[model samples]
Target: MRTQVAIIGAGPAGLFLAHLLARAGVDAVVLERRTRDYVEGRVRAGVLEQGTVALMERLGLDARLRAEGLVHTGTNLAYDGEIFRIDMAALTGGSAVTVYGQQEVMRDLFDAAESRGVRIVFEAEDLRLDGLTGDRPSVAFTRNGVAQSLACDFVAACDGFHGVGRASIPADVLKVYERVYPFGWLGILAEVPPVNHELIYANHAHGFALASMRSPTRSRYYVQVGLDERIEDWSDERFWDEVETRLGPQASAGLVRGPSFEKSIAPLRSFVAEPMRYGRLFLAGDAAHIVPPTGAKGMNLAVSDVAMLAEALTLHYAERDASGLDGYSARALARVWKAERFSWWFTGLTHRFPDMDAFARRMQVAELAYIRGSKAAQTAIAENYVGLPMGFGGEPSNR
Candidate 1:
């Protein structure tokens, strides 16, 4: 097979990149190691930053999202048995977030890609990239016992953190930075109306809890747990009890309890592999960086990364210009680091550290109080929560 670009992984990053490349008249093919069902059913982040929503709308993939997604102008922060609201829209001049599942986003992108005749090969195995430093790179994989080789001008590594993308790069060329937290989040999706109209982040002495929704009828909630915690030890009844206790009586009012249809424990980490591009191979989304879900920036960061990647690729093909492609790493990394900062900061503020001393706890309380009381502090929170403007190396946004 031959194409202008060979995209690895069919997750949001690769799929969106293919969609953008096609619209730009660049040919590309996507390869996924899992079946289509598995890819679309993976439950992940649900919050959509303002820029993410706008990008989907531009791609004509927001028909279902705009209809079904829950919009929030503000979010609540609970600590010391009290709830304080941050008016995101008011603070950020009408910027807000949308509650839309990552599964739904993939479904939409998949549907759009299929309808438009973009090639996606699922169930690919042992996917490998070759000659990334050369002008022409290629992807090799096996599908149903048949060996296939795809030649392309560029290779996009959107295969995620554990995928072959980063492993393919030489250790001497890639510098890795990672921080694995001592905790994880035990999350569940239940078929019940959400307890509140907006999302809430609670700071309890026990741990951190989050009250969020996938839709009006399907509530998604999470509580911080030790890294050693196991999902099998948690029962539906116990999960509900813990969630309610952490949220407090007032916030848990009208809390509807139901068996969770899906449950999982996700470890928290902040990881970034510097210089997202090496030769003709470019890493997008989770393949390049990861942030704790506290800031809700995982998928949003991926969308922004690919948007920059797509822009660079488009310029390369349309005008025979390689400037954007050359600067892709610096441009994408600029935004990736900012998101890491926000997620790290928010995680520290909300989560109870098991090893934290009295002084550290006191600082957490004081910071929460300051954010609740000060307009400037609230603005900083709202702006970062809703997302900062897309800036490429301090250049003014043309959007």
Candidate 2:
């Protein structure tokens, strides 16, 4: 197979990149190691930054999202049973986030791309990029026990953190910055109704708990705990009780138990890779950077990376210009680092450290109090929450 772009991985980043490139009259092929059903059903981030939603709308991929997504004007920050709502729209000039699962977004994009005749190969394994500096970079992979090669002008490594894309880069040329938190989130998806109108980020003595809803009929919640905790150790009753204790005393407005749909743990961390590109192969999304889920920036950042990449590739192919391509790494890393900082700030303020001394705990509380009391602090939080501007701060003209 031959194309202008060979996109590895069919996750949101890869799929969206292919879609955007196709609309720009670029031919691209996407390869995924997982089945279509698995990719579309995997649970991940749910919040969409305002810029992401706007980009989707411009790309004509927002019909279902607009109909099915739940929009929130603000989110509640709860501590010691007191709640403070940071009005995102008020602070960010009417820009607000929409609560829609990452899996759902993937489903929408995959379906739309397929309907538009985009090529996507699933269950393909052993993806390897070879001869990236040559005229035609080749992607070697196996599909249904048969090895095949895909020739392309360039390769976009949208495969995630554990994928081969990140490993393909030589270690000497890469500078990895990472910090893993001592705690991880024990996330659960329940069939019951949500406990609150909007997301409730609670900070309590026991730990941190997030009360978020996927839809009107489904609730998604998380509790901070040791990374090694087993799901079997916490019964349904115990989980609900812990949630109530952290959120507040049990009441009608409190969370009610329901059939658990999914339970898993995700370790919290902040990571970034300098210069998201090397030679003819470029890394985007989780392959380039990762952010803790506290600020709900992981999926959004991935989308942002691909959005920029698609534009860059379009410019390169349309105008025979390498300027956008040359500056792609720097432009993408700027937003990536900003998101990393924001996620780190939010995680540090909310999650308690095991070895935190009395003075440190007091300082954390004081910081939270200051954020609630100071309009400037709240505006800063709200601005990051809504999203930063897109398109590298210039007109959409090709660079």
Candidate 3:
């Protein structure tokens, strides 16, 4: 098979890229190592930045998102038993975030792409890229135990952190910056109304807790846990107790307890790979960078990455231009590092460190107090939460 682009992974980044390329009349093929069901069911982040929402609308793939997504103008930050609300819309010039699951976004992208007859091959195995430095690149893979080769003008490595995309690049050519947190989040999805209407990030003496929701009736919550803690160690009742204790009295009063259907612990980490391009191969989303879930920037970052990439590729094929493609790495990384800083800062603010001394804890309290008392601090928080403009300066022109 020959195409203009060979995309690996069926996640949001890969699928969105394929859809964008299709609309631009660029022939591209997507290869997924998992089935469609598996791709659509993977539970991930649920917050969409304003720019992401706009991009989805521009693509005409947000009918369901517009109807079902919870539009939040603000988010709550709790510390010292007091809740501080940052008016995201007010502080960010009427910008707001949409509470929509990453999986749901993938589903929407998949439907939009499939209806347009974009080529997507599932259950692909042993995917490999070759000749990325040359004028042409090819992806070798297997489907149903049969060998296959896809020749393309370029390759997109959206296969994620553990996938072959970043690994394919020689280590010497890449500079990696990473920091793994000392703890993890024990998250649960339950069938109950959320503790509050908007997402809440709570800081308590014990740990950090978050109250968020997927929909009106389905809630997603998380409590900080030790790195050694296992899902099997906490029962439903115990988890609820931990949540209530950490969220303080006001926010926990409305908490509804129910049997959780999904429980898992995710370790926190901040990571970024410099120059998100390698010859003819470009990496977007998790394949290029990762941020801790504190700022809810992971999926949104992926959206922006592809938005820029798609625009660049569209220009290349449509107008015979190469400037956008040439600058993709610098443009994308400039925003990536800002997100990393925000996620790291927010994580430190809300999470209790294992080695936190009295002075450190006091600093945490003082910082939150300053944010709560100062409009400037709140505005900064709100700006990052609602998301910076696509390029961190002006609105992205992709849409």
Candidate 4:
């Protein structure tokens, strides 16, 4: 097989890039190590930034999202049993996030790919990149135990952090920065109405807890736990009890308890692999960076990365201009770092630290109190929560 671009991974980044490139009249093929069912069924984040929604519309894949997505104009913060709402839409000039699951987004992307003429090769295993530094590059992989090769002009590595994409980058050229938090979030999916209309992030003496929903009938909630925690130890009853306690009285009002259908523990961390672009290989999404879920920036960050990557690749193909491609790394990293900071800050504010002294706890409370009382502070949180403008490198947005 041969194409202008060989995209590795069928995740949001790769699929989004495929759609963007196809719309630009560029020929590309996506390769995934897993089947479409597995990719679409994977449980992931549910928050969608406005830019992500815009891209879905730009790619003509928003019909289902528009119909099923729950839009939130505001989000709530709770500490010391008192809850306050942040008017995100009012603060950001009418920008708000959509509570659409990553699974739904993947389904939409896959459903439209064939009609839109984007090709994807699933179960492509042992993928290898050859001649990345040279103008002529190719990918070698296996499908059904048969060896195959795809020669392409460029490679987009969106296969995620554990995949071969980032590993292919030379050690000397890649620099990694990572912070693994001491705690993890034990979350559950229950078929019950959400306690509140808007999502809530609660900080208590116990830990951090979040109240969220996948739909009007499905609730998604999380409570902070130690890294040593185990899933078997957290029964459905125990989870409900703990989450409600951390949420406190006000936020936990009307909290409904039911049998949890899905439960898992997710570790928190902030990781960034610098120089997102090396030779003809550009890493996107979790392949390049990871933000703690505190600010709900994971998938949104991936969409933004691929948007920039798509623009760079489109410019390269459309105008024979290499400026965008040349500036891709610095440009994408500009936004990546800002998100990293916001996620880190938000995590610190709402999560209990193992080493937190009394003064530190008081400081966290003081900050939250300040944000509650001061419009300026609330404005800052609201803007970051809705996602900063798609302004890369501080110039005007072409998006």
lDDT of 3: 0.91
* Candidate lDDT (C-alpha), each: 0.92, 0.86, 0.91, 0.93
1-399 in candidate 3: lDDT tens per residue?
A: 999999999898998888888888999999999999999998899999988898888889999999999999999998888787899888888989999998889888888776886889999999999999999899999999999999999999999989999998999999999999999999999999999999999999899999999999999999999999989999999999999998888878899999999999999889999779999999999999999999899998998898889989999999999988999999998888888989999999999999999999999999999998899999988888888778622465331
TM-score-better candidate, 2 vs 3:
3
User: Candidate 2 local accuracy as lDDT?
Assistant: 0.86
- Candidate 2 local Cα displacement, residue 294, angstroms: 0.6
* Model 3 CA RMSD to the hidden true structure, in angstroms: 1.8
Q: Could you tally the backbone clashes for each prediction?
A: 0, 0, 0, 0
Model 1 per-residue lDDT tens digits across residues 138-245: 898999999999999999999999999989999999999999999999999999999999999999999999999998999999999998899999999999999999
Candidates ranked by lDDT = 4, 1, 3, 2
Residue-wise lDDT of candidate 4 within 187-233, one digit each (tens)? 99999999998999999999999999999999999999999999999
Select the stronger candidate by lDDT from 1 and 3. Answer: 1
**Residue 109 CA displacement from its true place in model 4, Å:** 0.3
- For lDDT, candidate 1 versus 4, the one ahead is 4
Candidate 1: the clashing residue pairs are none
Q: What TM-score does prediction 3 earn?
A: 0.98
